[model samples]
Target: MAACIVEPILSSGGVIDPPAGYFAALKRKCEERGMLLIVDEAQTGLCRTGSWYAFERDGIVPDILTLSKTLGAGLPLAAVITTAEIEQAAHDRGYLFFTTHVSDPLVAAVGVTVLDVLQRDGLDTRAAQAGSALRAGLLELQERHECVGDVRGRGLMQGIELVTDRATKQGADRLGSAVTARCFELGLHMNVVQLPGMGGIFRIAPPLTASDEEIRTGLDILDTAIAECVSAAV
Candidate 1:
């Protein structure tokens, strides 16, 4: 097998965070099969998960690492990192990799600046602190709302699954759409998972630079939207 590529936290997959030591166990399985373990940190890297990378919490280093999204800070740039032995092997095999717009100095500079700011401003720690407040707010909402079936995630990346009935855990797909539309109308754009069987999952990822007041304001907007939508349903 070439490699097993995975997103440390399933962002579009309902923002699911794997259980503790999950990656460690997966890595062991990969080793047994003589396959390379590749971690894709496009959405969870650069302090998005309260750390430089979500895989750090797993305590296992991947054989290959891929990064993008936050790395360019909106620009189109990506990176692949691997150990010297693997890199040498690939080079010896004459393997070539390049994107349509490769070697752009402007984007490269932006990526460097992003790294500098993430480190200089201690955004990793900021993400952790902000995530704590965000999760607390989400939990409070879960307690107050019967439709909030589940709240799960880590750091600034979180998700809340809406259900018609919490006891059944059935996805409230239509209600999810309504709440998102209401949130947009209220000037707070919300993202809901579009996949079948996961349509009720709402992905809530606030910017790491957001202030405490901003986070609270967003939560308030979300609360108002959910309440309005649920009331309209009845």
Candidate 2:
């Protein structure tokens, strides 16, 4: 295999975060096979996950790390990071890096400013604090709503899975749609996982800079939306 690419948190795949030491083991496997481990931190990087990188939790540094989304801070910018040895090897192999948008001064400045703000404001710590509140609220929802079968994720990125019955763990696809629509109507837009067998998974990744009051408001809105939707269904 050329390389093993993975997201520290499977954001698109129901925001699934593997257990601890998982990535460390995966990295060992990659090393044994003489393949590079490439971590795509598009969603979980740059303080979105309470750390600079989610893979840090596993204590393994990827051979190749790709960052975007958060780095742009709403603008369009991306970066690839690797050790000097790997970069030199690629250069020796005649690899050319060229992109029309590469090194645009305006976006580059924005990326720098984004990093500055994240550090100056301690957004990583903020994300961890806010995430605790988010997770707690979600857990409370799971307690009150039988359809809320699971709540999982870390830092600012969280997910709730709706099920027809918690015991059966059957996906409540239609209920998920209704809850999403209700949340939007209630002034809180939520993203539902579109993949098959995961339609009931709602991705709740609030901004790292979001205030505690904002977080509370969003949770209150979510609670109301879920209650209204579930009651309506009943």
Candidate 3:
């Protein structure tokens, strides 16, 4: 392949963080073939994955990096970053692409402010701390609830895969929606994904500004919802 594009952490498909050394090896393979390694950190960027960028966890750099979602801190803003060599090459080739949305000063200012706040507040560190606490809570849930087959992710972005049986890893596609609705009813909003082969996975991506109390409350709600659904099924 000339280039390979991948999500640093597969957020849409599932909150699946790649195994250790996966990206480093992938980068080598791309480099050997003289291919650009494009990383889509759109969902995992701006301290969402407990780091400034998800790729940083892999200890490698992407040739073309894409950022979004958190880039504007809730505003509609996105950006693509590349090395100077590529930018100079593109400029030399007279690559002209323009969009009104991309040039908006208001959005640009918002992006700057978002960066400033993230750095000044040490949100990356906050995300790490919060993620550890969240993961521990979810792990306890997995032990208590057989439906949560797996709990995996990094930083503030985490997930729990619903299953009917732990040994079989049977997907419980509808369970996510049930839990989601219940959690919402209890005052906690959550997102769930039902994908081919993967079944249902609930994503827990709380705001970086959320306090420890808020995080614990969300987890408590989630726990109650899942337990409620499983018991109802029984």
Error of 3 at 210 (Å): 1.0
Ten contiguous residues with the weakest lDDT in model 2? 195-204
The residue-by-residue lDDT of candidate 3 on 21-83, one tens digit each, is 999999999999999999998889899888899899889999999998887887899999999
* Candidate 2, 16-85: lDDT as tens digits: 9999999999999999999999999999999998988999999999999999998998899999999999
Q: TM-score winner between 2 and 3, please give it.
A: 2
* Model 2 RMSD, rounded to 1 decimal: 1.0
lDDT of 3 at 141: 96
TM-score of each: 0.97, 0.97, 0.96
Candidate 3's clash total is 0
Q: What's model 1's TM-score? A: 0.97
Which stretches of model 1 miss by more than 4 angstroms? none
Worst 10 residues of 1 by lDDT: 97-106
Candidate 2 residue 5 C-alpha distance from true site, Å: 0.3
